[model samples]
Target: MPIDHKQTYDGNNIFARIVRGEIPSKKVLETEHSLAFHDINPLAAIHVLVIPKGPYVSWEDFSANASDAEIADFVRAVGETARIVGAEPQGYRLLANTGKRAGQEVAHLHVHIFGGQPLGGMLAR
Candidate 1:
């Protein structure tokens, strides 16, 4: 289920906790503005979640509030994480679900990197 993009950032969300060093995650890469970690429940062989270190509820929020440096760092972090996870050679899908219909379970903005095998159609038929 997706969450309200306008909702205030939850400091206790799993990603937030992970960023704050309260929850443990299989970290892939950590930069000043972003953190990339393997998803606990992966849908693909190389599923990872790249999230900004700042408190943001959704992509819109992040885009509207995050600094230019933060945004640039986050973007680079996603690409770096994908390369580090060996997904570049095989191609990968970058997904950032926003709004209620997109199935964004977590309130925090995260870009999912899915790859390592044929992903088939972009959406189920």
Candidate 2:
């Protein structure tokens, strides 16, 4: 157990709350290992957040601790979310902010699927 692991995987995060059914979210896709839902503050025409059911704070934690089956299920859920949100036709961007500098607000590990229109360039410019 490392300090980063301890700091990153704070189980009481907002997404963790959502995973625990403590916070209501408009779900787009749900599997046994993951949950995909609409973002509260959407940045694109279609913005969905795909999160693993397990407690994790970043992609590193997920890759390090999750089984191959869990990872596959979670990744597949992202694609399913994109299709349900109508991002599968044109194009989509998957975003996972790992740390504070990257604007990762929630401590729970999640991927943001954005599409349905021209997202333009990156870095929020």
lDDT of 1 by residue, 20-55 (tens): 999999999999999999999999999999999999
Candidates in order, TM-scores: namely: 0.97, 0.90
The best candidate by TM-score is 1
Error of 2 at 12 (Å): 1.6
The deviation in Å at residue 67 for candidate 1 is 0.2
Candidate 1, residue 61: the lDDT equals 93
lDDT of each: 0.94, 0.86
Clashes of each: 0, 0
List of clashing residue pairs for candidate 1: none
